[model samples]
Target: MNSKWLWPSIIAVLLIAIWLYLPPGIDPVAVPADSDSIARGEYLVKAGGCISCHEGSEGEGGLSGSAAVESPFGTFYASNITPDPETGIGNWSGEDFIAALRHGRRPDGSFYYPAFPYRAYKGLSEEEILDIAAYLQSQPAISHSVAPHELPAWVGRWQMLGWNLLADWKEPGREMNDDPEIARGEHLVRNLGHCSECHSPRDALGIIQYRDEFKGGEIPDGHVEAIDAEALNSWTEEDLALFFLIGMKQDGEFVGGKMEPVIEHNTSQLTDADREAMAAFFKRGLPASP
Candidate 1:
């Protein structure tokens, strides 16, 4: 070996070692067939935007994921998550589900691309995860096969090893609001809602910038406005809550674009109280502007 290049080669080997070795938890259990748990799971799934991301185009597919997401990296297709024995998660145990949600690892022990948004979901409680699993299990099995992600030719699943190593996440806003409802809303926004995933901008590696969270930025299509108190000050919390259900603004303009599905499937489905909580959560710290 050439003496001059020896050090570089050693460093490259070490980097590979780190990536491979770090190739990275949850109880393996069956979901209860009870309706209550399943119901809760259904709600959580909606809150988590499972349908928005996994639902087939125009509601034709039910968690038969193939929803295309355009990003800088490439167009990634969501995978089927229905209870199909062959094509879906029918074989996945509760632990596999938990691992996928909390740790971003597939049942095969491979790293899932961050497009799955497991980083934000890591905060979910074990019971919440179980409920989600229950809800998914109850859905009718669909043997829909999904297309593989069309990321750049240079991008590969194996490359995720290196990508995961550099993962860092900051809480969006940890200020303890005295109001329990507001706190719950925060939990939903940060975790179940995964609101920051879209509303916030990302670094070069496509990680959400929690510190600048709700201070929206650009997406593949266009820019998302900041949703912080200052930005939404003109609207009362009541109006905000109503917006979640109706997707209409006080200005009479309806929310469209990427948020259409989110409103139609996720936030619009929330209970009134939960919607109020979310509205209060977003509008916290500022009184409605006169």
Candidate 2:
């Protein structure tokens, strides 16, 4: 038997498969010059909390993507997301943007570190993804070049394939009987808001454990712990809605730490009905604390 070539043949096949799975590159699309697209994108950007990691503050350099995101692995610098042709996503095609957001694959077919939260973003609809892209394109281009991520030698793009294989890549299926409010809450919480990404405990591979969904876990900094979503179930809907609206807990203490920015940039911007829906959804779905 020709056992000598067997290993080589297997390696070649695996390489070819990986290549086939790589996202294809496309030419950059022309940015839409309309106000409606920009407005929709603005709403989605806030809903997705893009500003928290990308902008840092309200003044200049918004979406320049220079913010530092610390993780258990290393410090990952957010890329320049502004429309700068040289340093940002200005020249990215709609497909290129979508590939990055939905598949975590760069236009050059490299994997983005999971710190970017593409796993949660993969659940977003195509229209929403495009709208976000359009909004980014409409922004004034910034020329900030971010430093590369400081990662361990073992952490590489190839590992992303294995991660995706093990992770829940598919969006959860919608139930036929889901009311509009429930559906909206589910979409906001699971996809755009991505609350569970922080709230759920993760395995060694940095994948969120479904068993611990919204049950609380250590944040990336290794010091602060995320509050369990189920814990919020004790609060009345009015209290929950008010908390989201004003960043004040039912106990009269102001929300602080990482959650402060989330409320400021994301939840505070949400509509009253949306906040109420989220409160109702959390109360109904999250398990009661023991």
Local distance difference test, each candidate? 0.83, 0.79
Q: Compared with the true structure, what per-residue lDDT tens digits does model 2 show for residues 1-290?
A: 39999999999989987775677554455545578878888999999988888883335467887677777888898888988999898888888878888889887888888888898898897778888988998888978778899888877877777788778553244452256776777778878998888888888888888766777778655544444555665688889889889999877999788889899999999999989888777776555667
Clashing pairs in 1: none
lDDT of 1 by residue, 181-229 (tens): 9888877787888888888888887876665767787878899878877
Worst 10 residues of 2 by lDDT: 169-178
Q: Which segments of model 2 are wrong by more than 4 Å?
A: 1-5, 8-16, 24-31, 56-60, 169-177, 220-229, 287-290
User: Candidate 2, 159: how far from true, in Å?
Assistant: 1.3
Which candidate comes out best when scored by TM-score? 2
Clashing pairs in 2: none
Q: By how many angstroms RMSD does model 1 differ from the true structure?
A: 3.7
Model 1: runs farther than 4 Å from truth? 1-24, 58-60, 169-176, 285-290
